[model samples]
Each structure stands twice: as structure tokens, then as C-alpha cells.
Target: MRTLTGREAVREALTEEMKRDEKVFLLGEDIGVYGGAFGVTAGMIDEFGEKRVRDTPISEAAIAGAAVGASLVGMRPVAEMMFMDFITIASDQIMNQGAKIHYMFGGQLNAPFVLRMPAGAAEAGAQHTQSLEALLYHIPGLKVVMPSTPYDLKGLLKTAIRDDNPVMFIEHKKGYGEKGEVPEEEYTIPFGKADIKREGKDVTIIATSHMVYKALNAAEELEKKGVDAEVLDPRTLVPLDMESIVKSVSKTGKVVIVHEAHRRGGIGGDIAARISDSDAFYYLEKPIKRVTGPNTPVPFSPVLESEFIPNEEKIIEAVLKITD
Candidate 1:
């Protein structure tokens, strides 16, 4: 096993996939020689050449559209948006064209592309920082993935590239440098599976992406307070692993959902709803709690941004609210 940053794991996944399948190619801004906005694609252009690792113009719409078109003709194109917020510019292509083509064309055509976006707040201001997985999760045809660890990042990205439908791969910018153990052998984590980062009996904390790390930290603090907390990561949101969620809730009887996205219309709310709707409702000892970002744009000030993002303190508070 080797310890690697989330960035390195993703780069390795992309490199392995490109070499394993000729149909797999990358297209994005500053991805070729510049090695992507976050340097996830560093050295790929030199290894694969410009035709496979392309640097596109500053147009999200064109980038997404080209990916959709390429996928229609049997190419697996992984397109990257410099920022998750800019994905709005390419919504039409992703939501309407790529998402609909498979169903609308009687299964004759499918868009097997992956749209990679670096998301979450890093004091990057409102324009660049947003946990917008909720937007893509709402769309019926897209598969949304938000991996927290370097191992999961590599495995999920490999799975996303091989799937026959469109995938929205979200990388939390704040977690890009985080290191975790990753194996040298090839592996892929299936979609719709939950990874329990920690096991507990008092409460269950369901979180995504960067928030998973915060939840784990909160679990540690809870342990010190004699409150055992289980932290679970959905890994992929669209095809959510509700069975695992319900099972955790059944065992713990208390659950708290955490995310950096706004509390309004966030995926946390939806998870809470599903739990309430399922048999897990009877297992609840108290109302489901959520520790989420406020219903406001991300702030530019570091202090304000810190308050805006959900952290270990917030997660612990939410857990205590129900457990006590």
C-alpha cells in the first residue's frame, strides 16, 4: 500500500484508464501542459499526447457539448470544469443533451462521459466555491459521485469512466491534498455502496465528500464524551445506498446528516426524507438532525467562510442534540 493525495490518486486513475482503453480521453481547460487547474492531470499530456489529453478554450458549454458528442460515437470523454459553479454554463449539454440522449433515442445512443468538477469552499469566494452536488443529484439521468478519501477517489473515478451513462464526479477542493492509503493493484468501487468510516452504536453520521472527514473528527470527539458515533459516506449520491443508511440508523437509532451545501434543498434533506419514508423511521429515537451550511452564498472573508462551512464542531453539536 502507498499513501497518496486525492490529486495523485485521481491522476493515476485517469492515466490507467487512458492506457487501458483507447476510447478514454480527457478534455478541459489548462489540462494539457498546465496539468489542470488543480494539477490532477499533470504529466498526462506528455504520456498520452495532445490528441488524448486536450486543452480546450474557456467555454464550459463547448467542453461539455463536445464530450456528449464524443460519447455518442463510442468515445469515453472525461471533461473537467475548472470550477463547479461554471457547470451552470454547460447545464444544457449535461442535463438536456447528455442525460436525455440515452432514454430519448430508445437506448440506441448513450452518453458515456464523465464531468469532473472541483467543488466545496476553500475561501475561494462565492463564484468558485460551492457544494452543488444537489443540483446534479436532482437530475434523473446523471450519476453523481463525491469521494472523500484518496482510495475511494481512484476507485470511483475508474468506475465512472467505464460506465455507459453520464457521470458527475465531484472532487472537494479542500480535500485535494489530503492523504490516504491506496493500493498499487487496480480496483473499482461499485456505485450505490456506502463506506462506513467508523463504527458506533450511539449515533450515525451520514456525510459526503469533505464533510465525511469532519464527521470522522466529530466521531472522535463524541467518543471522548462517551458517545459512540458511526460515520458513513454515501460515496455516490444519485444511486444512494439507502439500505446501508437505514441499517446504520437501525443500529444506532440516531442519525445526523452533514454537508457544506446550503441547508435549503441540500442532499442532506433528501437523505433525511428517505430515512423518514423508509422502515428506518420506526428506528429513530429522535428527529433526524442536519449540520449544513447556511442558506447564503459563500463569503470571501476567511472568518465568515469558516462559519459558512460545516465542521467537526457543528457535527458534534448536531449529534449531541439528538443523543442527549
Candidate 2:
């Protein structure tokens, strides 16, 4: 087992997959010599050359369109948007063309490409910071993935590249430098599977991306006060592992959904709704709670930004509400 940062694991996955498949290539602004905005693709250009690792102009629509076209013609392309906010520019291509191609073309065509973007706030201000995992998955045909750890991202990214349809690979900005154990051997995590980061019987906490770590911290603190909290990470949301979530809630009889996205219309709401609509709703001893960011733009000021995002303290409070 080798320990690597989330960013390093992404590079490793890309390098391995590129070597494994000749059709796999990368294209985006500053990805070649500049090594991507956060250096996720550093040193890849020298290995794969410009033909496979293309450095595009500052045009997301063009990057996405090129990927869609290439995938349709039997090439696996990974298109990177400098920031998650810029993904809106390529929405039409991803939604109208890439997402609908297989259905529209009578199942004769498929778009097997990945749109990778760095999301979440790190004092980058309103325009630059956003959590768009929920927004992209709103489209009918997109497969959304938000991996919280280096190991999960490496496996998920590799799997996303091999899939026969469109995938939105979301990397949280704050988690890039975080370190975790990853196997030296190549492996891929299946979609729709839930990982129980920590197990308990008092309450179940469902968290996504960066919030998973925060929830784990909260769970540890709760344990000291005679509360046993179970932390469940729904690795991918679209093909959500409702069976695991329902089982966890069924045992704990209390549950909380957590995410960095805004509370309104956010993925947290969708998760909570699913549990409530399921037979597990009768198993809950208290109403399911959601600890989420406020419905507002990411603040530029450090103080306001910290307040805008969910924290360990907030998660603890939410858990206490249900358990106490």
C-alpha cells in the first residue's frame, strides 16, 4: 500500500489508463506543459506527447465538443474544465449532444468521455467557487462521481474512462492535498456502492465528497459522549446505494444527510427524499436531517466563506438533534 495525495492519485490513474488503452487521451487548457490548473496532469504531456495530451484554448465549449466528437468516433477523451463554474459554458454540448446521443440515435451511438472539473470553495470567491455535482446529474444521461479520498478517485476515474457513456468527474478543490492509502495494484470501484467509513448503531450519517471526512470527525466526537454514529459514504449519487443507506438508517433509527452544496434543491435533498419515500421511512425514530451549506453564493471573505460551508461542529449538532 502506498500513500498519496488526492492529486497524485489522479495523475497515477491517468498515467496507468493512458498506457493501458491507446484510445485514451487528455485535452484542456494548460493541461499540457502547464500541468492543469492544480497540476493534476503534470508530466503527462512528456510521456504521451501533444497528440494525446492536447492543450486547448480557453474555451470550455470547444473542449467539450471535441471530447464528444472524439468519443463518438471511438476515442476515449478526458476534458478538463479549469474550474467547475466554467462547465456551464459546455452544458449544451454535454446535455443536448453527449448525453442524448445514444438515446437520440436509437442506441446506435455512445459518448464514452469524462468531463473532469475541480469544485468547492477555497476562498476563490463567488464566480470561481461552486459545487455542481447536483447540477450536472440533473441531466438525464450523465453519470456523476464525487470521490472524497485519493483511493476512491483513482479507482472511480479509471472506471469512468472505461464506461460507454458520459461521466462528470468532480474533484473537490480542498481535498487535492489530502493524503490517504492507495493500493499499488490497479483497481476500480463499482458505481452505486456505499462505503461505511465508520460503523455504529445510534445514528447514521450520509456524507459526500469533502463532507465525508468532516462527518467522520463528528462521529468520533459523538462517540466520546456515549453516542455511536455510523458514517456512510455514497461514492456516487446518480446510482445511489439506497439499499445500504436504508439498512444503516433501519438499524440506527436516526439519520442525517450532509453535503457542501446548498440545502435547497441540492443532492442532500434528493438523498433525504429517497430515504423518506422508501420503506425505511418507518424505521426512523426521528425526522431525517440535512446539514448543508446556506443557499447563497460562495463568499470571498474568509470569515463568511467558513460560515457558508458545513463543518464538524454543524454535523455534530445535527446528529445530536436526532440521537438526543
Candidate 3:
């Protein structure tokens, strides 16, 4: 295995898939020559050229409209929105058009495209950093994936590009430069699969995207305090691996759900409800706790932004309370 940054892992997957299939192409603002706002697609335009590695206008709606049309005509277009907040500009095309095509047309058509949204709060202000994963995951026909590590990002992104329905592939802005091990050979990670980062007995910590890393750190700290914690990553929200989550809760008897997204209407509520309603309901010793972002717009101040995002301390506090 070789190590690669999350940006490199994503670029490698896109480059390999583009070379493998002629129909696969990249399109978005600053994605071609600028290499994406986060440099995830750096040096990609040279190999794929302008035709495939297109630099679209600043209009998110136009980018999504073109992607939907391309997918309808048998092209797998991967479009990126520099920030997830801009998703509102393209919501019509994504929700009304791409999402409904397969079901609206009696299964006679499919919009097999990928919308790459770079999300999560930083100093990028309120507009550039909204975790809209749960918002889009609520759509009936869309597939939502959030990969935290380079290895998982590379594999799951390749799978999204090859799938037959529209997919929302979210990349955490903070994770772009983070490095991790990825195999030299090609591999694809399946959806609805939860990866248990650590095994424990006192409590289960279910986290999404970058929060998985935070939860892992919290688990380590909890261990020193004599409270064992299990960390689980639900890779995809729509096809979430409730089986793995339920099993972990059944064993640990206590749970904490963490995410960078705001608490109101986010997937965290759904996960807690599901466990309380499942066969594993009786396994619970305490109510499931959620360490999530406050239900407010992202702050612009560096200090406030840092406090806005969920961190290891929050996870540890929640676990300690539940374990107590």
C-alpha cells in the first residue's frame, strides 16, 4: 500500500476512470486549469484535455443542467460545485429533473451523473460551508456518499461514477490535504457499508465524514479514562448500514452520533430513531447522544468557526455522560 492525500486519491480515481471509459468527463468552475478550488484535480486537465476536463461558468445551475442533460444522453458527467452552499442554485435541476427521471419515466431513463460537492465549515464563511448532505439525501432517487479517508474516497468515488443513478458525492474541505494509505492497485468500496474503526464495549460512536476521525480521537481519550468506545463510519447516508450500527449498539449498549452537519433535520435524528425502533431497541441502557453542529449559520470568525465544527472534546463529553 502507498500513501496519498485525499486530493490525490480523488484525482487518481477520476483520471483512471476517465481513461477507462470514454463517456466519463469532468466539468465545473475552476476545475480544469485551476485544479479545483481545493486543488483536488490538479494536473488533471493536461491528461484529459479541455474537452473532457471542462471549466464551466460560475453558474452552479448551468453546470448541473448540463450534467443532467449529458447523463440523459449516455454520458457520465462528474460536475463539481466549489462549495455545497451553492447547491441551492442547482437544486431544481438536481431535485426535479435528475432525481425524478428514473421514476417519472417509468424506469425507462436514468440520469447517471455525479455531483461533487465540497462541504464542511471552515473560515470559508456561512455560504461556502453548509453540510447539505442530509438535505439532498432526503430526495427519493439520489444516492449520497461521504468518504472521510483517502482510501475510502478513492474507492467509493469510482463506484459513484460507475453507478446508473444520479449520485451526490460530498468531499470534506478539511480532508482534502489529509493523507492516508491507499492500495497501488485499483479498488472500489461499496455503499451502505459501515467501517468500524475501533472495537469497544462501553459505547458506540457513529460518525460521518471527517467526524469519524474526531470520534476516533475521542475514543482514544475515553479509553485512558477507563471508558471503552467503538467508532463507526456510515459511509453513505441514503443506503446507511443500519445493520452494522445496530450490531455495535447491541454490543456496547450506549451510542453517540456525531457529524459536522447541524442537528435539525439532519440524518443524526434518523439514525437515533431507527435504533430505538429496531430489534436492538431493548439493548440500550441510556438514550443515544448526538454531538452535532448547532442549528445556525456557519460563523465567519476564526474562533467561532472552530467552535462551530464538532470536535473530539464534544465527542468525549457525550461519551462520558452516556457511559456514566
Candidate 4:
């Protein structure tokens, strides 16, 4: 097995899939000559040519509208929104049109297209940095997938492209540079499946996207303090792996849901509600703790941004609160 950066892993997935399926095409601003804003699609235009590796104008809505139309006509268009915030411009096409087509047609039609976006806060500031998974999760027909590791990145992406619905594949800006080992052979990780990054019994920590790495670090620190924390990563947000969460909480009796999204309307609230409604709720020794961003816009200053995102220390404190 060879280790690869998150960017490399995603690039490999798209490259390999495009080689295998002619319908798979890349379309977004700066994707052709510019090789994409993050260079994830670098050199792809040379291999696939300009038609497949398209470079559209800076219109997010047009990009999504084109993807929806392409998918409807039997093309698997992998549309890219340069930034996650830009996705809002295309919500009508995504939420109302692309999402409802399959159901409205009563399974007579399928939107087998993948929409990729660079998401999450790193240094890009408020407008560019947002964990918009909750918005896609709210939609009934959209499939939301976020990967924290290179392994999950390749696996879930393949699944999303092959599935029979519209998929929102979110990539964290910070995770793109991080490296991890990934298998060489082709494989797929099913949607709605959760991966337990670390198994323990004292407490369960549920996290998504970049927050999963923070929760893992917090788990290591908690272990040194004589607390065992189980870290569960729900790779898919819409079809969340609630069973894995319930099983972990059933054994640990204490749980903390951590996310980079705001505390008020974040996915952490939904995860907490799922657990509170589950039969495993009786096993809880304490209330489920939620560690997330404050109800404020992400700041541009490095210091303010640091405070805006949840970190290992904040997760550790939340775990301690639930345990003690």
C-alpha cells in the first residue's frame, strides 16, 4: 500500500474512474488550464482533453444547472464548486431540481452525478469556509459524503459516483494536504457506513470531516488521563451510520458529538437527537455533550479562526464534562 495526500487520493479516484467510464467528466472554473483552484485536477486536461476536463466560466449556478442537465441526459458529470460557499448559488438547481428528479419520476430516472466542493475553514475566512453538510443533509434526495482520511476519500467517492442519486462530495481544505495510507486495489465503501477510528469504552466521540482528526487526537490525550474514548467517523452525513453510534454509546454510556459547524443548527444536534431517541439512551450515564463552533461567522484573522474551529483541547474538555 502506498501513502497519499488527500488531494492525491481524490485526484487518483477521478482519474481512474474517468479512465474506466467515458461518461465521467470534470467541469468547473479553472479546471482546464488552471488545473483547478487547489490543483486537484492538475494535468487531467492533458490526459482527458478539453472536452472532458472542461473549464467553465465563474458561474456556480450555471455549473450546477449544467451538471443536472448532463446527468439527466445520461452523462455522469462531476461538477465542482471552487468553494463550498458558492454552492448556495446553485441550491435551487440542486435541492429542488436535481434532488427531486428521481423521486418525482418514481425511480424512473436517476441522477448519477457527483458534485465536488472544497469545504471547511482553514485560512480562507468566513465566505470561503463553511461546513455546509447540514444544508445538504436537510434535502431528501441528496447524498452527502465527507471523508477525513485518504482511504475513505477514494472509497466513498467511487460509491458516490456509481450510486443512483445526486451526491455532494465535500473536501475539507485542511485535509487535502494531510497524508494517509490507501490500498491500491479498486474497492468501494458503502454509504451510511461508519468507521471507528479508535475503539474504547469510557466515552464515545462522534465527529465528521476534519473534526474527526481533532477528536482522534483528543482521544489519545484522554487515554493518557485514564479515560478511554471511542472515536466514530460518520463518513456519510445524510445516511448517517446511527447503528455504529448507538453501539458505541451503548457500551461507553457517555458520548460527545463534535463538529466544526455551528452549535445551534449543526449536525451534532441531529446526532445527539438520534442517540436521545434510540433505545441505547438508557445506557447513558450522562447527557450527550456537543462540541462545535459558536453561533458566529468564521473569522479571517488566524487567532479568531482558531477560536472558531473546535480543537483537541475543546474536545477533551467536552469529554471530561460528560465523564465527570
Candidate 5:
């Protein structure tokens, strides 16, 4: 095994996939020469040449539309929107075209492609910081994948590239610099599965991306007070590892869902509802808790932004209340 940053792991996934498949190419603004906004694709252009690592103009819609067309004709394209906010500019191509083509055509053609975006907040301001996973999760035809660690990032990205469908591979802005162990050999983590980052029996803490780390920290703090919290990362929101979540809740007899996204209409609500609808509902010792951001838009000021997103304090309070 090798330890690497999230950015390095993603780069490795793209590089290996490009080497294994000639049809796999990357297209985005500043991806070729500039190495992407986060430098994740820094040296790819030099190694693969301009054709495989293209640098497009500042047109999000055009980039998505072209990728959708390319995927239809047997190309596996990975289109990157520098920031997740810019993705709204290409919603038509993504939601209507890339997401619906295969199913609408009765599986005659597959949109075997991926749309990558840097999402979540790390003091980048309102427009640059958003956990918009809820939007993609609402769409039936798209696969929404979010990785919380380096190992998951590499394996999941590889799976997304090879799958015969459109995937929204969300890279949390704050997770890229974080490092973790990843296997040197090739691997793939299947979608629709949950990873139990930490196991506990008191309460199940379901989290995503950076929130996973926060939950784990809160769990550690709770341990000192004799409260154990299990941390689960659903990984892929669309296929949503609901079974694992339900099973965990059945054992723990309690659950708390957490995310950095705005609380209203967030994925936590869907997860909570799924549990409430399941046979595991009777196992609860207390009501399922939810810790999330405020409903207001992300703020540009550091002070206001910090207050906007949920933190470990909030997670701790919610968990403590569930236990009490």
C-alpha cells in the first residue's frame, strides 16, 4: 500500500485509466497546460499529449455538451467543471442529455462518461463553496459519487470511468490535500455500497466527504464520555447504501445523519426517511438526529462562512442529545 493525497490518488486513477484505454481523455478549462484549478491534472498533458489532455475555453455548457456527444460515440470522457458552482451553467446538458440518454434510448447507447467538479467549502466564498450533491441525487439517471479519503477516491474514480453510465464524481475541495493509504495495485470500490469508517453501537453517524472526518472526531470525543458513535460514509449518494445504514441502525438502536450541505432538503433527510420507512425503525432508542448547514447561501466572509457550515461542536451536541 502507498499513502497519497486525494489529488494524487485522483491523478493516478485518471493516468491509469488513460493508459489502459485510448478512448479515455480529459477536457476542462486549464486542465492541459495549467494542470487544473487544483493542480490535480498537472503533468497529464505532458505525458498523454494535448489530444488526450485537452484545455478548453471558459464555457461550461460547451464542455458538458461535447462530452455527452463524445460518450455517445464510444469515448469515455471526463469533463471537469473547475468549481461545482460552474456546473449550474451546464445543467441542461448534464440533467437532460448525459443523464437521460441511455435509459431513454432503451439501453441502445451508453453515456460512459464522468463529470468531475471540486465541491464543498474551505473558505472559498459563496459561489465557490457548495455541497450540491443533493441536486444530482435528485436525478434518477445519474450516479453521484463522493469520496472521503485517498483510497476511496482512486478506486471510485476508476469505477466511474469504466461504468456504462454518466457519473457525477464530486471532489471535496478540502479533501484534496488530505492524505491516506492507497493500494499500489489497481482496485475499484463498487457504487451503492457504504464504508464503515469506524464501528460503534451507541449511535450511527452517517456522513459524507469532509463531514466524515468531522464525525470521526466527534465520535472520538464522545468515547471519552462513554458514548460510542459509529461513522458511516455512504460514498455514492444516488445508489445510496441504504441497506448498510439500516443494518447499522438496527444494531446501534440510534442514528444521526450529518453533512456540510444546507439542512433543508439535504441528503440527510432522504437517508432519515429511508430508515424511518424501513423495518429497522423499531430499533431506535431515540429519534434520529441530523446535523447540517443553515438554509442560507454560503457567505464570503470567513466569520459568517464558519457559522454557516456545521462543525464538530454541532455534531457532538447532536450525538450527546441522542444518547441522553
Candidate 6:
């Protein structure tokens, strides 16, 4: 076993995939010599060359559109948006064209492409920071994935590249430097599966992306207070692992959902709704609680930005509110 940062894991996945499949290629702004906005693609250009690791103009729409076109022609393209906020500019190409082509063409054609988006607030202002996976989850034909750890980042990226559909691979901006243990052998985590980061009996904390780490930290604090908390990570959003969620909720009786997205219309609300609708509802001892970002734009100031993102204290409070 070896340890790697989230950025290194992503770069390794892309590098291995490109070498494994001739059709796989990458295209994005500053991804070549610049190595991407966060340097996740550093040193990739020299290893893969210009044709495989391309640097495009500063146009999100063009990048997504080009990926769609390439995928239609039997190529697997991975397009990167410098920031998840800019994904709005490419909505038409992604939501309308790439996501619908396979269904529109009677399944004869499919866009097997992966769009990598670095999301979440990291002292970046409203214009640059946003957890917009909820918007992508609304699209009918697209698959949304938000991985928290370096290990999951590598495994899921490989799976997304091989899948015969459009996948929105969302990465948290603050997680790039986070380190985790990753094996040297090749591995791929299946879609629609949940990873139980920590097991407990008193309460369950279901979280996504960066919030998963916060939830685990919260769990540790809860244990100090004699409140055992189970942490579950739904690695992928679209094909959610409802079975795992239900099982966890059924055992713990109390559950708290956490996400970096806004409290209103966030994935946390959707997960809560789904739990209420499932058989897990009868097992609930109290109402489901959510620890999420407020319904406001991300602030520019470091102090305000830190307050905007959900953290360990908020998660612990949410768990205690329901468990107590």
C-alpha cells in the first residue's frame, strides 16, 4: 500500500486510462504545460504529448462540446472545467446534447465522456466556488460522482472513463492536497455503491464530497460525548446506494445528512426525502437532521467563506440535535 494526495490519484487514473485505451484523451484550458488550475495534471503533458493531453482555449462550452463530438466518434474524452462554477456556461452542450444523444439515437450512439469539475468553496468567491452537483443530478441522462478520498478518486475516475454514458466527476477544491492510502494494483469502485467510512449504532451521518471528512471528524467528537455516530459516503449521486442508506438508518434509528451545497434544494434534502419515503421511515426515532451550507452566495472574505462551508462542529450539533 502507498499514500497519495487526491491530485496525484486523479492524475494517475488519467495517465493509466490514457495508456490503457487509445481512444481516451484529455482536453481543457491550461491542462497541458500549466498542468491545470490546481496542478492536478502536472507533468502529464510530457508523458502523453499534445495529442492526448491538449490545451484548449478559455471556453467551457467549446470544451464540453468538443468532448461530446469526440465521444460520438468513438473516442473517450475527459474534459476539465477550471472551476465547477464555469460549468453553467456549458450547460446546453452537456445537458441538451451530450446527455441526450444516446436516448435520441435509439441507443445506437452514446457519449462515453467524463467531465472533471473542481468544486466547493476554498476561500474562492461566489464566482469561482459552488457545489453544483444538485444541478447535474437533475439532468435525466447524466451520472454525477463526488469522491472524497484519494483512493475513491482514482477508482471512480477509472470506472467513469469506461462507462458508456456521460459522467460528471465533481472534485472538491480543498481535497486536492488531502492524502490517503491507495494500493499499487489497479481497482475500480462500482457505481451506486456506498462506502461506510465509520460504523456505529446510535446515529448515522450520511455525507458527500468534502462533507464526508467533516462527518468523520464529527463522529470522533460525538464518541467523546458517548454518542456513537456512523458515517456513510454515497460515492456517486445519480445511482445512489439507497440500500446502504436504508440499512444504516434502520440500524441507527437517527440519521443526519450533510453536504456543502445550499440547504435549500440541496442533495441533503433529497436524501432526507428519500429516507422518509422508504421503509427506513418506520425505524426513525426522530426527524432526520441536515447540516448544510446556508442558502446564500459564497463570500470572498476568508472568515465568511469558512463560515459558509459545513464543518465538524455543525455536523456534531446536527447529530446531537436528533440523537439526544
What lDDT is reached at residue 273 by model 5? 93
In model 4, the runs with Cα more than 4 Å from the true position are none
Backbone clash pairs for candidate 5 read none
* lDDT of model 5 at position 23: 98
In every candidate, how many clashes are there? Answer: 0, 0, 0, 0, 0, 0
Compared with the true structure, model 5 gives a TM-score of: 0.98
Q: After superposition, how far is residue 299 of candidate 3 from its true place, in Å?
A: 0.3
- lDDT of each candidate versus the true structure: 0.95, 0.92, 0.92, 0.91, 0.92, 0.94
Span of ten consecutive residues with least summed lDDT in model 3: 121-130
Candidate 5 lDDT by residue in tens digits, 1-324: 679999999999999999999999999999998899999999999999999999999999999999999999989999999999988999999999889998899988878889999998878888999989999899879999998999999999999999988999999988999999998888899999999999998999999988998999999999999998999999999788889998999999988899999999999999999999998899988998999988989998889988887888899999999798
Candidate 1 yields a Cα-based lDDT of: 0.95
Model 6: residues >4 Å from true position, as ranges?
none
Model 1 agreement with the true structure over 1-324: per-residue lDDT tens digits: 779999999999999999999999999999999999899999999999999999999999999999999998879999999999999999999898888888888988889999999999997899999989999999889999999999999999999999999999999997789999999998999999999999999999999999999999889999999999999999999899999999999999998999899999999999999999999999999999999999999999999999999999988888898988
Cα deviation at 240, candidate 3, in Å, is 0.8
For candidate 2, list the clashing residue pairs, or say none. none
TM-score for all models, in order of appearance? 0.99, 0.99, 0.99, 0.98, 0.98, 0.99
**Predicted candidate 2 versus true structure: per-residue lDDT over 1-324, tens digit per residue:** 679999999999999999999999999999999999999999999999999999999999999999999999989999999999998899888889899999989999999999999999888999888997888778888888999999999999999999998999999988899999999997999988989999999999999999999999999999998899999999888678999999999999998999998888999888888898998899989988999989999999999999999999999999998788
lDDT for model 3:
0.92
Question: For residue 290, what is the lDDT in candidate 4?
Answer: 89
lDDT score, residue 268, model 2? 85
